[model samples]
Target: MRLFEDNIHIEIPGRSTPSARSPEAEPSLDGKVNSVSRREAVEAFLRLRLFMPERQKRIVATCMNGEERQYFFDKMVEIAATVEGMPVTYQQDGNGDETIAHLHYFLGDCHWYITEKDREGEVEQAFGYAILHGDLINAEYGYIPITELVDTGVGAELDFHFKPTPMAQIKQALEDRYG
Candidate 1:
């Protein structure tokens, strides 16, 4: 099995692991995010997070040792929490979930997502929530030096998506080519 296929889990300080949640329960910070499905939230988060300037750079730093990986990972977790808390600050639904959210993150690249049927031939997303689909990665995050998911053109593509370009690598590529 692939390391990421169904094993995608991000650690939030207060939230349970995605692997631990029920098939219907999507992991949220304070309580259950029943309004927006887990898959949608995570995908929305991913769609925005990967495009950050700092985050884009972190993708390149993946070559670092284990300790460094932990450091960057922690930073990302922090970003996710900050974003999640944004909408909830105003008001909450009867379900204690927020309906309106402002995704201040992915405004840079105009990199939104278009979901096709997932590998299982099913897919969905929510405007209130977002997730980081390392699986849906097709473009490089602005400075991150990681290879992204390529469109297989066989099974359905993830409806939620983001565009990433390794800012660091692009700079390096330019330097190597010119200098």
Candidate 2:
């Protein structure tokens, strides 16, 4: 079955039935797909889940069974662990200096500019400036759990085009644009 399309397109094999046709094919980066297991297909779907819109998510959810949903979360945790967190030095420096935000997460007017992360902790926590619904007065640097951003229903998205930028510069830009 054809999942969805974006930068990369994935087509997982459908079940065996007389009515079932061959999976609609989409070449990956390498342009080859000899075979794909159900687990692998689910993994690919979860990896791209963050970037997908709410409508697409609902559609995908309907296609997935309870087992697949559980697998998706388990795989997500594994994937999260592999992601490189903020450096120890950055955490130690605190928010005193003009720290660089290495990651940007956004959904509509809300934005999370991640500066530091506690990699050693059981639950991944990011220290960053958050501006929710353009509330500049309330926006402040604080701990934001990575899990919150990855929640399937939340629809939060990581800005793939964002580059590391100074918090001061970001603040200045926000002020110039919003003020």
Candidate 3:
């Protein structure tokens, strides 16, 4: 599959490998040839983690050497430094139908649909709808410190399969499920 717009290409084995190109034609990171820029590679890696099916990830993993995998992970940390978290006002200016929840954190029967985040404060806070212990009646929109969720031990997990969804839809789904 084509990984970048540049001449550098990686063909999934079983498919034909492109004829040898000049060593000077490929981009190099620490003297190793790479088909894409570090940022693009890292972005692709993140997309793979979030969006690719588990089977697909296994297929891709089989294609990468341990060194290549390590390089991508190391670069991911460096690239993620510049990426911004959810802003405090994220989706707040919009109605429920327009506001989107971009993150999902869950522990047992508790679920947090995180629509916004405040990183400017000393303690990071997330704003969203929270349902605790399946209590739909008490579920409401509010802020919670991110540390609280992180400190919830190993039970809490960020749902990697969650897609950004409108708050209205999420609310309706919860109502339908819990009512």
Instruction: Order candidates by TM-score, high to low.
Output: 3, 2, 1
Instruction: Note each model's CA RMSD in angstroms.
Output: 16.5, 8.7, 10.0
Q: What does candidate 3's lDDT look like per residue over 51-110, in tens digits?
A: 233443454454332324444444434323322344465547556666878677787899
Error of 2 at 131 (Å): 0.4
Per-residue lDDT of 81 in model 3: 30
- Give the winner by TM-score: 1 or 2: 2
lDDT per residue (tens digit) for residues 41-95 in model 2: 4665665464344655565555444323333333333434333444532564755
Over 4 Å off in model 2, which ranges?
1-85, 89-97, 120-123
Which regions of candidate 1 fall more than 4 Å away from where they truly are?
Answer: 1-66, 88-179
* Per-candidate TM-score against the hidden true structure: 0.22, 0.53, 0.54
Winning model by lDDT: 2
For model 1, state the Cα shift of residue 177 in Å. 38
lDDT per residue as tens, model 1, 4-96: 346444697965554565534433345544344334434544644432444433442442222223323334444444444432222323322
Which 10 successive residues of model 3 have the least lDDT summed?
75-84
Clashing pairs in 2: none
